[model samples]
Target chain A: MKGTFRASMAWLHTGLGLVTGWVLFAIALSGSLSVFREGISVWMRPELPTVPVQTVDATAHAVAWLTDHAAKSSAWYLAVPNHRAPYVFGTWERPDGSYIQKALNPLTGSPDGIRDTLGGEFFYRFHFELQLPYPYGRLIAAIAALALVVGLISGLIIHRRIFADFFTFRPNKGQRSWLDAHNLLGVLAFPFHLMISFTGAVTLVTMLLPWGPQAVYKQDVMAGYTDLDPALESRAASGKPGHLTAITPLLQNAEERFRGAGISQVYIYNPSDAASLVTVIAGNNGTVSTLSHSLTFDGTTGRLIREHVETRPAVRTYTFLYGLHIARFTPDVTRWLYFISGLMLTAVIGSGMRLWTVKRLRLPHHLGHVLTDRLNVGVLGGTSLAFASYFLANRLLPPMSPHRAGHEVQCVFIVWGLALVFALIRPARRAWPEMLAACALACFAIAAVSSPWTNPVTQSTALVSLLFSGAFGYAAFRALNGKAKQT
Target chain B: MESAGTLRRPLATAGKSLSLKRWDLACRILAALPGGYALAAFSGICLAVWLPGLRVERAMTGMLTGLLIWPVAFMASFAVPDGRKMLGGTVIALLALMGLAALRGWRP
Candidate 1:
């Protein structure tokens, strides 16, 4: 019974790991890194240098400048600076209604005109929502997160060694290396695995929660969100027109009210109306979640109606957990930590796939290991090919090509498709070697070919970018040409 | 020349050669920097509690709540050690921490 049980457990883990592993890892890794997307974007652009004595006047000035220049905005979000964040970003709804983000200069408090920066938001979107169409993509991502929880729990139950494995990495040990890597990955943030599982699952609880709303609340799901947050009803307009009072006063009042809460953004709604609401959202640096501790003031009368800080006990706990998951007001180092774990999670998925193929090939059975080998090469090789090609296409395509984004996406899929094709014709062992080398060279060459054509950066920056591409290409090429022959 | 017989032996010995401790190590290496971040995430939250301005108390029930994760994560590392190994590693790590702390004070 014991032997059978262990065998079953192993099989189940392997199966589960193989099935949803890639998606789960991708989600985890991307979400992890995105924790610091804002910070990373600033560092990457390096447009904003630190300055002291930045004023609410300067911030208001910037907002005014943006509002004047904004030919496309209906609503504007002005991101106020925190202790760690250097610059503020104003997000506005474009003509198409998509959120367009612009960085605000800390010095002049004006729009800095830095463009093409989706920032860490892209990764975040990819991680959780995966660019899938709204409800479906979100649902699938949530399910994958649930699978991760399962994988994490089952892994703990099955692992016999609780300590002996801490600092063990024996290199050139074939399958042993993989096993070591897997264990090491699992162990590193075992705590994170546990927290992320619950938090990630909770992050999507609206979808996962027992169809209580569908069964009970029916059409009143909006009521659930509103009930959970009673603050929404505050400052609701009574249909009278009046220009807004000075924003500076509201900002000051909010700062005083929240005290340590660290006011980050002042959201003004129903402006020039008697019922306008001015909400001061707390900065995320010191906070754990995105649940804003807001104090809403009426527009004309200037009276405080609701404060998130003054919520009931049950609602407060609910908000706290939600905040923890959203990681609204986390610090710089913490966000980086999120990013690092995210990268590791990606590696976990990739490695798990590699292991699946490796084991399948090693065990030559009635079914030839051909499919497994091909799958390994296709997924691993194809991912590299697709990413490299996308970068290449990004540079090579016409600057004004209406189809540039589509074309870049096409190139990615085309290379990915070629990988599957290559696997089919050749022996999996031979296919891996040749395709990897091709992918490497293609990656290296594409960067070189496109550097002069459409790159927007300076010569040095473009060269550095090419060099970066070359490094990865070289690594891939070297790996494919290694002494470790396909068995 | 004597390999045909030996080739089969490996498959047979696969089960016997399996090391839970080794497997544990492999997972950790894979976990990498993110693993550290995961801990940092919680600790980051906990640090919020330490702030004087935020009304969090030492009496929160969940203070010990997260301690449970340390064992789970550690055990997941497959770090089951004898009394001596665990004690020795802990002592060494603590000594290192102290030295670093002392250096931090001195430098400042």
Candidate 2:
């Protein structure tokens, strides 16, 4: 009976992992990249200066720019410049219901010469949204996260010699090597994998199971949100036009009130009206909770209106989990640790899927075996190549091209689709090494095309790309040699 | 004649048991997936309605804690060898939770 139970758990682990492994891989990989989302945004736009700027100066620049260009906008949102992101990120809602987003210069407050692109925001969105519309993508991603949770639990149960196997790695043994690698990666970063999956699922829990809120709020979702993170009472815009007060003092007041937590976001409502209000949000620099104290001020007079801080324990707990997953509060060193662990998690998923195929290849070549093997190469290899192409697209596309951001995103999907087709047409043995080689070439190209070696951010980004290039090149060589041995 | 009859009985029972096992597995899957989710949702509803706190806080706590039920329910569904018992137990627990929620003024 005990043996049967273990066998059943093994079955569950394998089946669940196989079903959700690809989507989880994509999510994990993109999530890993998103750890450096701000840096990647900076890298994508080489036109932006990397010199650090003061928060007040950046906010002033953004406010001035919005007042000049987006005066008619209902509201303007500004993300102040920080250590990671060097420029002010601003977005405003126009009267026509359109939204414009730009990275404003800290010195000049202009978007001059900056190309239009989603930058790192693309990967961040794709991490959770999966490029699908509205709730569908989020729903799918959430379900995949839940599946990952189940997979991890079952995998733990099935890995009987977990500690014993951690120190064992027999290389060049084909299937056994793949299993060992998968187990090693999974076991090495087990806590990170578990935390990430559980937190990832919890982040979207409301969407997955809305019954709790539904039962309590009964169609009043906004009320529940108000309770979770209370905001100042919103007022309608008075039609009378008024001149806006300077924002620098108001931000200083908020910073003082927050006790030097620094200001992260500023929201200006009814910018040209008498009822204009400015809301300054505290940055998540020092706290594990994303819930921060916010201060609202009268936009016309720059007088304090109200201060809001989350005090509810339950709400604080929820935000802490959410913030842990977002990792915005981490310092530079901790952020790198997050990034490395994220990559390790991705590697675990990839190797686990590869183990499934490698184990089956020794058996008679059934259709299922053939298809899984081909897809394993296509998805795992193709995504890496596609990610490399995204960077390549950013560098190669015309700076002034219309709809350039959309085109860059399209480049990713188009290359990924072509890689899939290439994998399908070619034999599995050839496809593996060929795709890895292409990935290496693309990474090398990205490093080669980067300019201005003086900037530390750009230099480090290029160095990372070169490192990836070397890794992929070595993998491609190994794959080619392994195929030669089989023949 | 008795020996021939015993042999025939074992053959028929073997054929019947194979189909029965397949049905059991199918039922177990159903219980694990959709039924497990239903159990989790109902548990969330119960917590939201019955827990003592501000309405929103109760709801948030319930939602957060309720999501954890899914994996446990999923594993539990397979841990039991009898599929019928597993499905029946899930249904009973879900109904009881819903009943408790109803008593606490929850609707829909």
Which candidate ranks first by lDDT, i.e. highest? 2
Instruction: Give residue A387's lDDT in candidate 2 (0 to 100).
Output: 86
Task: Give per-residue CA lDDT, model 1, range A38-68, as digits (tens).
Answer: 5444433434554553546655665556545
- Return the top candidate by TM-score: 2
Clashing pairs in model 2? none
lDDT of 1 at A170: 49
Interface RMSD of each: 13.7, 9.5
Candidate 2 wrongly placed segments (more than 4 Å)? A484-487, B1-20
Best by DockQ: 2
- Please count the clashing residue pairs in each candidate, in the order shown: 37, 0
Model-by-model DockQ, in order: 0.02, 0.26
- What's the TM-score of every candidate structure? 0.67, 0.94
**Predicted candidate 2 versus true structure: per-residue lDDT over A56-75, tens digit per residue:** 98889888888888888998
